[model samples]
Target: MKKLITIPLLFFIVFPARAQSSSLEKRVSINISNQPLELALKMLEKEAEVHFSYNPRVLELDKNINYKAESRTLDHILNEILGPSISYKVHGTHIILQKAPKRDFYISGYVRDGESGQEIKNVSIYEPQTLASALTNTHGFYKIKLPVQQKDIDLKFSKKDYDLLIQPINNRSDQKLSVELQKTIKPKVLTAEVSAIKTPQVKLDTTPKIEERLSSNSKPQPVPVPEMEVKEKKVNIDLSEELAFIDTTYQKGKDHFLNWLMTTKQNLHFRNIQDSLYKPIQVSFLPFLGTNLRLGPVVTNDISVNIIAGYTGSVRKLEVGGVANFIRKDMTGVQAAGTLNLTGRSFAGVQAAGAANINLGTSSGIMAAGATNISVKDSKGLQAAGSLNVALSEIRGTQIAPFNYATRLNGLQIGVFNIAYDRTRNSLPIGFFSYVHKNGYRRLEFNASELNNTEISFKTGVPKFYNIFNTSFSYGRPNKPLAGVGYGLGTSWKYGERLGSNLDILSSVYFQEGEFSYLDQHYRASLGFEYKVFDRLAVFVAPTLNFYVGYDESLDFSSYKLLLSERTSRWLGENARTYTWLGYKFGLRLCNKS
Candidate 1:
């Protein structure tokens, strides 16, 4: 029973190997006059049930093959037809046919400068025939793997500001070659001046002749010489030396200290030493505890966990700190801190801080801070803070804070007060006071009303809303000639490019015969249509509703009143203290439009 089992196991293993070898060696009759190499290979593949692998670039696929075989092995036919330069090796059931490999070789070493002996980095070492290339590392070490080829290979080494070197190498085995390159000297152009004096010598005849002629009796004239005036030279005064006498020793020291402080702050690396450390995960008891570098000058990690604080050169994924998180260069992922989150360069993704989020450079993602959010250069996303949001350069999105300030804005600001130093066209400021230095609107208007014949109004604010101050003087009226001052609010709505409408409400007190008494008070509301005749000039007409309150009979409404002809209605108990009338107004305005 044991012999029977062993014999069956041996037959099962040996029969498969024998069958595979027989399949490779078996061949059939193939008769073709001029067939493509691919078609001929396909015939062989069908008969032998095998696949062939070779580099298509090295094979002539379109070439015609003419062969006739009768019961010849595939291996014998391939060897006789494809020549000795091409060979085949059996790997499992497939046959790998390729150009015969010569010998494998490699070249590796360091590249340096000829004079300084300093290693050169980023030097390109290439072989043109094989298209194989390699670059030197920071230490100027390079290794190039070469395939089997001709005996000799030429390598070209090149870099900027250095002369290129081409060396011919024989590939017998692996080699270690160290090459030094020389610096190229640029030629300078030299200029020289050549003077040539080639004049022919000529003889001159010395002769003086005075011909006799009729002389007229005329007086000799005297020529007057003009006097030359001398111009005074200007002397330059040196104010720098004169101003040096002023005592600014304390100011100089203060400025020096401030500059030093800024430099130190920018150079404050979290790691104490400069070395490359890539950690997949890091955990710290405190900011300084469990850290290889005392400060951690250059720590790059995927994730970081801190008990009190976290300091790293850069964080790629996530960093959570109990108190604060400070990054020296850039933080690309989420960073959360209990107290502060500060980045020296750029901070992308989400950043949340309990106290403040400060980015010294540009930021593109969202920032939420309990106290303030400050970006020194430009911010392209949202910044939300409890107290203030300050962008020194420009903001492209929204800013929400108690107070918002930006140098230039292209977004929206929602706060108690918003201020932009430059003009902003796309930014809308929604606050109690919105101040834009270059885009504010101011106008002076002269208007005439039924109660006040002549009035001068000053309007100043943003284009959408403005404050109005008006003073009016009326003469030739039924009552006494009065002067009054009023304060109001006005807003504008655009109808077209050069036309708009305005709504205004105002209240005023009139002074009668130079008396400082509030015996008469006037309230007016008007809606007007404004058209811009010129860039700085506009005209407006409005119908107004006026209410008058007088202690005595000092209310007037008689001249050119468009409406409310009757005054018999005692709307407020028939007393002279209160009256209402309808009127119309016409005005001309001059202002700057943003």
Candidate 2:
């Protein structure tokens, strides 16, 4: 009983003492003058009642030390003696000292306009290679922290309406920098006859090192302006600019929601952010739930898989989505989706979708869709869709769909209805109805042919190729009561001011009382002379060599004489008769211009 009571007393006494010594907050007094660090620490250990533990090489115990503390906390004494090169941790009654880790460097500066010397806010300051960026505040002040790097950093500053500035920085320590930007100036307007604008001279600064200005105890000092050089850039500006489709209009309903969801940081900073960080792979359930976190749309990925839908900055290799893939910028490789694929800028490779593919910028690729494909700018490759294909600007390749539309076409279009708003001399649009708006041939004619007494026809397309639709009535034959409708293609050439020639091939189906009957096909080569009688009216007469193919021999031919006739079995089967004859036609053409 006496031994147990004594042991308990000893434990209580020792536990309190150890707890007091363990805490660096404990007050201690020490005075060591011009003593070795090894000896000084030994003296401090006794005063603080704590053991000093460290690697001798790191602590450099042989170094001389001079420190004094009067009733100060152990923490204060240790901080003064250790300096910043070494750090210490407490464990029980012991202090373990080790070398400190490398510190992060800071860069802070101001941005101003070159001429006005006024502060400019919202200017983007970034390191292109590292993608480390910061923006200037309202006061045009900015700050960024950077890790230790081996080489110099290339920093860039950019803003709209201002010239881009690039600064090389040596980030060995903290620094302060100031930059000036010149505003972009518009050239003087010239006469309408001038097709291009001359190049302008620009002032570009020389790359200079931004010196370190930060000190351990004081703030950064003022920075000096770097030197620059004046350089001339040869530029030819065309007044007749190409059209581009960028949705700047306000949106509502579903469009608004989808755009909001797919909108990314890159879209807002495309002009300033010239580089994108590469990501080898990305897997996402949705735009917000991706492996890239909130920066999903600011990185280019090699392979991207989305379960439902995904949004990204760019695609370098392949991207597939269960529903849709929305790209904020360019796509260079294959991109496929179950429902839709969309790009904010250009695309260069193949793109396939179950429903539709839409690109707001130029497309130089092959695009296939189940429903439709739309390139709002220039398209350079093939596009095939089930329903419609549309290129609002220019198309340099073929388009095959049920309907096709382009502002200018340099290739071919195969669809039921094709329309080109601009002039195309070498393009061919093969369909039931084809229309070209500029310098295209379109005319409505009323004429009497040898076979049908009353006929009305409409022609629309380019002069090189056009579509024709005509319907005729044989009114005097009451007993037969025949009506004919025809579809054909024709080519026209203007010989002079008032003379033109046309070659047409038409196949008309004649029926009585809307019942199927026989087919009448004819090829006519004629030389027409048209005299403009009014602003939108012209009278033309043409003498033609007509080769007629008639399926029904029961039709009377007493009114007209044939130069040549042959009876044989052809596409319409037995009793098919072919006749060659000379015919004459006179018509009034109603058109937009003569």
C-alpha RMSD of each candidate structure in angstroms: 21.4, 24.4
User: What tens digits encode model 1's per-residue C-alpha lDDT throughout 301-415?
Assistant: 7887777876666788998989877666678889899988887668889999999998876788899999999997688899999999999888999999989998888788888
Tens-place lDDT digits, model 2, residues 75-132? 7888888888888877778788899877667789999999999999877787644456
The TM-score of candidate 1 is 0.45
User: Alpha carbon lDDT of residue 98, candidate 2?
Assistant: 90
Q: Please list all clashing residue pairs in model 2, or write none if there are none.
A: none
- TM-score per candidate: 0.45, 0.56
- The local lDDT score (0 to 100) that residue 337 gets in candidate 1 is 90
Superpose all Cα atoms of candidate 1 onto the true structure and report the RMSD in Å to 1 decimal: 21.4
Weakest 10 consecutive residues of candidate 2 by summed lDDT = 243-252
Worst 10 residues of 1 by lDDT: 265-274
Cα-based lDDT at residue 431, candidate 2: 87
